[model samples]
Target: MCRLFSLTSRDPVSPMLAINALNVMKEGHDGSGVGLCLRGLGGPFGEMKEAPILSGIFTEAGLKRLSQVSADIGLDPKYSMTFTPKTPPPPGTPKRGTYLARAFDIPDAWKGLAPEELAREYTRFRLMLRTTGEEQGDMQVFSFWPDTLMVKEVGDPMEVAAYLGLDNKDLVARQILAQGRQNTNYAINLYACHPFFIQGVCSMTNGENTAFIPIREYLASRGVDGYCGYQSDSEVFAHILHYTVNRLGLDLEYYKHVITPLTNEELDGHPDRENLVRLKQACRKLVIDGPNCVIGCLPDGSMFMCQDRKKLRPGVVGGKPGVFAFSSEICGLNAAIPDRDTSKDFQPMHLDTAIVRPDCQEVTICSQLQALPHLH
Candidate 1:
């Protein structure tokens, strides 16, 4: 399915490291792209971004039409705000459109059901999009890659197709990353994240759950220690996580938390499959005392210019530039952190900086993953 995944180990990858990786994959998939905005800009928590083309997606004319149609059912002023859709750019325009509800602040009951939530929100977003998602045309939100990893160095399309065993490159647009293994048996086409269009009723893609509810149930029942979620940006992620944790009455220091990918099936449902309750339980015990984790992820190369803009200072790896990258690569990192040049020849950084990072950043999802080879 959606192939993005991260591997964490106290000896290697930690929770902070996982968050950084997840941040890289999700840096670009923000509320601005979706046309959502929060009322208050400076709340303690992160504010939502207004989708770039809010006015265009929901036009005055379209709102009028919706009003008239809704008047028949008294769904007027009560939901008038729902009528004003974010505007959509006309055809042939570089800028695409956003969903109307995305920009509007409404009850979770009023928004689109987010089916894509888990380790690889990006990959799941693509997968859900392909199954039942839709977005602004300009954004090409549904264009998944034949292989997400091949994007590491910007290789030719043909080269990517060759590595992913893609017979019909034309059929795939969004990136879908997966590692090449000698005995790979993963059912790679079952990604739960997919593009979705919001409607009056909150719904999700490919018959998945409304939001990450299914994933939550999966994790809670399995006793996993990590949390899986999606937002417009890292700040929004921070906000949501901050609020949710407070709601649960748990402080940030209860233990180390590792975020990771829950399989696509887990996001929606693994029909005919048993839950991974025991594995999740083990995860909780491990993280309740520690915060290390392996988060699922994929790099958004589009931010090649804004790499380190959101990276936390006093980085986890000290001065290893790309270790806690905002985006995926150093060139991408260069865009975010213009001061540091990863290209500079050996500036005397940690040896791990040169960890032969592969194009497919996907590593052993964790030896722990192997422990539950049959999690489903």
Candidate 2:
């Protein structure tokens, strides 16, 4: 088991707001590591929102290779901010690594393309750097997208936050996703931590994915790029969301349908049953099998939370419209939004998908396979 916390607000807020809440559920996680992704960025990143921000850890030798590769690719880094942790790492913990955040201009060829197309290219570019940098040395790439930054390290959530200067820095964002991983069945790997991102879609989960193999095969077959690393079974959720909205050109609600399709008996009554039947047949490989809760954000900045059909995982989605919070427990939401109506905070039903955005409102996109109460 692990813990996941994410919040989206109209105004830029510190990621510590989410990480602090995640720490409340420390008991559920062994403090193996913390992974975070921030969008709708502000603070030092506020002014550089238009250019893609490259984030990752690099060795001195790896840095030199990065420079050469950037020149070779023709996407020169325009500005960079490197953070060296001031807080000493805890005993038995690995030393803090050199993390770089660089901004680069979109290639001239992609200048007037659709955002989805351009975002795809940005994802591909980041993958190239990750592949190339890995051959150079101890280099790891997280994300490269406009108005986004990601930080991950192996340690306690609070300690990792402090090591990264998350509180002291001028960094802020309207949306942040953080995870405290509890390794099960596999060795501890930083890349396997949650809050995985592909292109503009980012996700963090609280449970495992039994259906990972088929989903991974489906994604790899897409042949669009950025789907190779399966360090974590949960990474497929982000790729599924990416495929649903970005590749399939479907709404976020459809993502819930693809991953948790209803049985034929239930779908027989659905208004969109005909189309859903085709969708289910076409995307059967994506139907996840396991108790899971997913909190994710789209390239457009809209945030969503959904549960698997079994609803085995614990999760709650609540808060005002513009400042929604999704977490594995109420304690987390309490830490971030204590004043909000706890009574109003409700756990999403098995078929319900909650959506929030910069606008102050919450919307539920439920499965059409089931009928609303008192409908007849």
Give the best candidate by lDDT: 2
lDDT of 2 by residue, 239-330 (tens): 99988887787877788888998889888768777778888899998999888999999988888888998898999988875688989999
Error of 2 at 343 (Å): 1.8
Residue 125's lDDT within candidate 2 is 80
The local lDDT score (0 to 100) that residue 279 gets in candidate 1 is 31
Query: What is the TM-score (0 to 1) of candidate 2?
Result: 0.93
Candidate 1 residue-wise lDDT, 1-376, digit = tens: 1111222111212222322332343432221111111111121111322211121223344445434533443322311111211333322222322323222232233245453222233234333333332232221222222111111101222232233232322212111221111111222111112211111000011111122333354434533222233321121122222222332333221111222223444434533123334333434322111111111121221110000111221111111323323222333334323454354322111111111122323111122122222211
Cα-based TM-score, every candidate: 0.26, 0.93
Cα RMSD, model 2: 3.1
Best candidate, TM-score: 2
Please give the lDDT score at residue 130 for candidate 2.
80
Native-to-model Cα distance after best TM-score fit, residue 293 in candidate 1, in Å: 7.7
- Model 2 misplaced stretches (Cα beyond 4 Å): 112-117, 363-365, 370-376
Q: Which ten-residue region of model 1 has the weakest summed lDDT?
A: 199-208
